[model samples]
Target: MSSLCLLALNHSAQADEAPLTLPTGTISAPALDTQDISLQTPTSAGSRLGLSALETPASTESLSGERIRQRGDRSVQDAVSRSTGISRTGTPGDGGTSLSARGFTGQGSVMQLYDGNRLYSGMGTVTFPVDTWSVERLDVLRGPASVLYGEGATGAVVNVIPKKPFTGEIENHLRLGYGSYDSQQQALDSGGSLNDTLSYRLSLNRLRSNGWIDRGDSTSDFISAALRWQATDDLAFTLAHDYGDQQPMNYFGTPLVNGRFHEGLRDKNYNIGNDKQHYNDQWTRLTSEWQLSDSVSASNELYYLKAQRRWQNAENYNWDTAGQQLLRSGNFAIKHQQEQVGDRQTFTFKHSLFGLDSQTLTGVDYNRIRFQLNSNSPFNDALPDGQPLDLQHPDKGRFDSASAYRAQFQSTTKQMSVFAENRTQLSERWSLVTGIRRDYVQVDRDDLVDGSQSDKTLTGNNWKAGLVFALTPDTSFYGQYATSTDGVGGLISLSPSQQQYDLARARQSEIGLKQVFWDQRGEWTLAAYHIVKKKLLTDDPGNPTLKQQVGQQSSRGLEASLELQLPHAWQLQANAAIVKAQYDDFEEQVDNQFVSRSGNRPVDVPRRTANLWLNKAVTDKLRAGAGVRYVDARYADLANRNELPSYTVVDAVLSWKALRNTTFGLQLNNLFDRQYAQSQYNEGQQWILGEPRSFFVTADYTF
Candidate 1:
């Protein structure tokens, strides 16, 4: 349930003084209710037109920070997985923040944004905004999104809405926690009016853990602060800054022995003893909104971001059955430095179109990005066939690579886009919504090692049309068709071979029903969609050594969710999705031959997934909740030679209000001690083990 309203009023007065006159500007508040799961809440992720989830023609959902905390979701990825048709596909290389949705995997298909601004992936990786302490709510749009964003959003969009400042009485919050594996958490937040015309907010959080796996240590620190200034009755401005530093767990995955997982090896860390993985990010933005008139409004945002990341470790491992040992290779040291600057301006108007009530919006966006990469490539400086280590009694060695890292490549990208959206009421029971977007992208790449440079120019057009009909005052039926585009991987870090290919094109058709029943005590939604993507790069049949952009992939699926507030203080929420994802026309190179994989499922895609959560208030001061999640088996390779098994996990939480402004909680995760794999590496040769059973005790205080 989300309780963040789109419109709120604030008194522009100091604590010791009264306002000179009534203010006309509005202030948006964060979602503070843990039990308010209503689709009627307005969200920006689904449509820039300010449509609520129940009114949008696509599948959308919102999860509030308070709700996420009550459910014991510690990370952004874990919190997002609670939504429908979404799953985690994170790895060390991607900063453990990547996701898979709508049968599409990786950052290329599923785009991530912060405060409505995207932080482009450098090398198919995103490492910032992984912490949820600063998040107010998470908005998700689970379908073709290129019509709203730009290319590389063919699957879904996730927007992280940070907490903002509001003019009110002074308030502060503090939280502390201790959990299994020597894990600890500390967080603090404060916000209030600094003056009659200014309000501010600041948040700080730190997390540290000695992970379940041997030698697995991790730490993360984050700071977020903002200031809001009300310049006039109809105008306002806000400036915000955020910074993050992280050192993720060094363990990559456990090598499979003889093509099978061994429970005894699940806790082993296969990486070098002194493995290094770090990420640092900084973001700054200035936003302004002006209510020009009763029928017109304008808004603008300018933002800048800087990021640095580094990784050094043995990333891959394979079991040597003949020698009864493990082979470790793929050793490399890599670094990335990136900077981005962008601005967005939008104008909205309310008027009559063809004698009907209508609202329209027009916007322009421009961005420039610069990135540089440093790495040790080719692996020629390492021992051949990999260095062998004992399987049972291994000694984790230091990172002693003979090759030295050097500047490899640098890239500059300039992107420009123009978009528009319109919604009109055709009749008392019918409405229409339409949108269009055009994007121009230019990329220049320099091969520093070879002292050669090349550039490419690309253009993409996207559009969507949707129809909504009111079956009853409480139920609505909608249908839509949308088109999108996506790059092979990260556009800025395209390799020489990848740069030669064009972007892929995709289309989707969807229909859904939204209804609120049981006298507004229950709500349910159902949606069905089919998507097809073309121009995928695949092996050329005429020439096995070359590639052609003529392959195709498709997926069809059904998604459903239900939330009910029953009697006896019991509340229930459930969601399920079934997807049939496969390569429609494709070929893969295997054993020096082009093999047809037209009918096989894509790697790392689950066919079935479901979640169920139930909460009950035993008394006015005590509450308990339980949840269950299940994921179906998934193939790990193009040929479908290796399959990962299905798994189910359970979590429970209990909290008691000990004081007027304080609460204590006890949370237990993976109650059954289920041993499951979260992700795979090297074509199923290894599996990243999920966290084992753990428990935490926490205290939260507000003043």
Candidate 2:
């Protein structure tokens, strides 16, 4: 179903272009899809200078909307999974968009953002399966980026760029699609200027489906809008808003039998009938820019985000061999309500620093977040004869009783940061890049269970330096060392004792080569890195009441990627990575005694990963594409007791230009119907089944 949205992306795509007029009043951004999809000649991923990807010293990649739509991606995960080294680490629903990268995973390491604003779930919460229809481009920076974004990005940062109002002739797009699992999709995009001083953009999408699992149904809608005002030649203002209401796939996961999957029960769901799970979010932002002078510029942004989530279901399950039945033990009803408000001010200038050509960016940011959670389990009876429900025939209504929580908890986080980065040209062929950031974080939590409270305040600093040398006009070599930090208890809450725990710290060093080959249409990057993470929290062996922060983790790895624009309108892209990650010095209290877990690999982290994709225009009217994704085996738990075997999936797409503005297409996912778990936890005892082979057809029109 992914590629169907691209049915009309032929040579005559000018009618679909959506150019955005910038707040700077004099600048405009052409539809990114019209540019080279691979090189991304202009981007803000690694630098605010608008440097080409080839010049950005970091390992960064950007994919245009056209490229993502061509692959028929529906969610943020869909687009990220195609990138090399990035492995899906959790379900898309629940904002469970955890990703494994570099040598770490989760919210404390890998970060995700909407636009340039960090979704700071601080407590491992991520925004839900954000529909791709609202994304204009995705930029990924695969290493420490704390200098740009404050804290917690030792692994990587994924920035989702949304569609903004652009100055252009009126253009609109409509797409309709249907797929396996009884899925339906409809989307609309409209953007243009009302006049020379005012322009607007709006995107809307509606989706529904009966999921792959029995009785698993889902419905979702997303809407985004932006209004831009070019009040004068020196200043401008813009406002944006986003809303999402979702009922994601109801299937939690299937339980394993005898420590292994049972193929016959693959389509079964353990949730109760009439169960409920839903998420809703609303966001608003205001931004303004002023060109104070030719050598100076300033900008400011303010935003607010609110979200609510609910879950009611029979969430945990396992097979009872002796009883010859399916054992379900947990019924949970939980709710989360969170809100965030923030502001940022930035100043940039171009000048001669110490007689060297230099470009500088300095910014200050402040953010405040309020979060709360409530839950209740009404049934103390583990098995009202439902303990071992008959596997052959589960009572459709046996576990239908609703849940009620006895209490509610509250938490709040406040943070402020000041950061500065300068790029100085040391010479015609050499450049120096340096930046630093200092952050002050405060957190307060109320434990309703005991009517107790805990609060903590911490501060940390991060910095990075890099040296770049241009060996030739089309080739370059670079080396960099960067540092960052992780919260003592992730970003949300901290253990009572750890309230004083120093934030975990991390540092990484890397060397890489960036080159343009096969003329200007191709590029290749090779990089190697060593990273160390320390101050991991663990219980004190000598004193059970105390906690220690001596644990450490390390990883060394190599990554390579090649992108080529081949002859005859063909394009090829391939990337792969191999890493050796280990818990260098980790210990835990087992059976009231300390036990070593020094050599185990981090859970859900694969040692190797790779992806390959190819697209060809067989004729001016037809286009075809194929891709393959591979992930090596990984541990599901910290003890390494359970292993999730490796898997490879194949996907294909074919599209036809049926008319001047209309296109039709078909997409096949998991072409071989591969049976594999996307990821696993709970000691590999529970399996999150991967999507099965599915098909979809789509039609698109422009007006």
Candidate closest to the true structure, highest lDDT: 1
Q: Per-residue alpha-carbon lDDT of model 1 for 1-703, expressed as tens digits?
A: 0000111111111223321222244634342334465777888898998887767888988888787888999888888888888888888888787787888888999999999999889998888795888888889998899989999887789998888887778789899999999999999988888887788889899999999988889999999999889887678899999999999888788889999999998788888877899999999999998878766788999999999999989888988889877888878789999999999999876655545566778899999999999998764436768888777666688675667789999999999999888777789888788888999989999999999998888889999889888888778899999999999868888887788888899999999999989999998999999999999989987887789999998999999999999999999989999999999999888777889999899888899989999999999999999999888888889999898898899999999999999999999999999999888888888898788999999999999
Give the TM-score comparing model 2 with the true structure, all chains together.
Answer: 0.93
Predicted candidate 2 versus true structure: per-residue lDDT over 67-94, tens digit per residue: 7888877778778978868898875333
User: Residue 558's C-alpha lDDT in candidate 2?
Assistant: 93
Angstrom error at residue 156, model 1? 1.1
Q: Please tell me which predicted candidate would have the highest TM-score against the true structure.
A: 1
lDDT of 2 at 526: 93
Which pairs clash (backbone N, Cα, C closer than 3 Å) in model 1? 1-36, 1-37
RMSD (Cα, Å) of model 1: 6.1
TM-score versus the correct structure, for each prediction: 0.95, 0.93
